[model samples]
Target: MNQILPLELPNGISLEIKREDLLHPFISGNKFRKLKYNLLQAKSEGLETVLTFGGAYSNHISAVAYAGKEQGFKTIGVIRGDELGDKITENPTLKFAQDCGMQFEFVSREAYRLKTEPDFIAKLKDKFGSFYLVPEGGTNEYAIKGCEEILTDKDANFDFVCCAVGTGGTISGIINSALPHQKVLGFPALKGDFLKDEIRKFATNQNWELVTDYHFGGYGKVNEELVQFINQFYQQTQIPLDPIYTGKMVFGVIDLIQKNWFLDNAKILMIHTGGLQGIQGMNTILKSKNKTLIEVQ
Candidate 1:
């Protein structure tokens, strides 16, 4: 559902958020869209196990764990940071995945860097039996195919579509389905130019551009200001945005509006690709450092 934000903006600019977060309790937002067909294909191939990769607090990991279990497939998560293996109980995301019966293979950060290598994957297959592989962030062709369904006819009226970019999958799908006159703006959570090439590999349209200024340092890095903004936004809108993606994108959109970057009377639709599951983990970190926490109800 598209929810109109009650913010008063200059230039008659209108804002609405596509609450993809409400799609499911666990497999919500783009995660649901990205995994829809991939899981089906796995089942079609008579696969009984699904293996994927992520970090300690990855939303993809959490979603895949619950979704795989719900779909009657055993799940394995190849996690970065070998140290996290022993810290599972203290980490909400890892603990939740474990509770969902997702087995984990913790690898060193250096070894995790070889995740895309064929030799590394061959070693994994040698260690574990044959299983369906869902790449990190779930951005394979099948995943993108699923993400393309995010925008429907009801969204056609918007002048611009906005979303947070991670692995470039969600934005690529939005770019594919967007109208010719509508522009798609992607706010990448990480600081890098490589995402453009990643998006190009899947996106067939030229209507989208990346707004790279709002990462607030890099992936998984947040400050008090961002925490405050997220808290305030939720208090006002009653919409909880995960700090990693949607929060940053919404901050960027509102900042751009204040700067008068968009034309007058433009209507913007933002995709709330859910990562709310990570909030508990993030809040745990914030508390350790005595930083402002993201408010949740």
Candidate 2:
């Protein structure tokens, strides 16, 4: 559903949000889109186990765990940071995945970097037997195919479509399906220009660009200012945003609007890619540092 924000803006600009977050209670947003075809292919191939990778509070990990269980596939999460293995009880995301029957193989950061290496995958297959692999962040050809369905003919009137970028799959899908007149803006949660090439590998059009100024440090890093903004946004809109992704994108879009970066009378659509499940884990970190918490019911 698309809901227009009632905020007053300069130049008669209008802002509306696509609530992809409400797609599911667990496998919500882009995760749902990315996994839809992947799970189907896995089942068609007669694979009973699905293996994927992520960090401690990765939305991909949480979603894959629940979706796999719900679909009758055994899940294995190759998680970064070996120390997190024993800390599952203290981590909301990991605990939830465990509760959903997702087994974990925790590795060090250095070893985790080799996640895409052929030798590493060969070792995994040797140990765990045959299983369908879903890359980290769930970005693959099949995932992009799923993400391409996010936009519809009803979205053609919008001048700009904005979304948070992680693995570049979702934005690639958006870029592929966007109308030629509409520009797709991706606010990456991570800091870097490398994502451009990643997006280019899949995106067939040149209607998109990444706004890199609003990462708030980098992926998974948030401060008091961002926390305050998230709390304020939620209090006003009654829409919860996860600090890692959508919150940062929304903050950047509004900040750009305040700076009059958009043309007069421009209509903007923001995609809520859904990472609300990470809030509890983030609040745990924030409380440890005596920082303000995001108010989400």
TM-score of 1: 0.99
Residue-level lDDT for 288 in candidate 2? 93
lDDT (Cα, tens digit) per residue for candidate 1, span 134-220: 999999899989989999999989999999998999999889989899999999999989999999999999999999999999999
lDDT of candidate 2 over 217-240, digit per residue (tens) = 999999888999999888888899
**Where does the lowest 10-residue lDDT sum fall in candidate 2?**
1-10
lDDT at position 289, candidate 1 = 96
Candidate 2 overall Cα lDDT vs. reference?
Answer: 0.96
Candidate achieving the largest lDDT: 2
Clashes of each: 0, 0
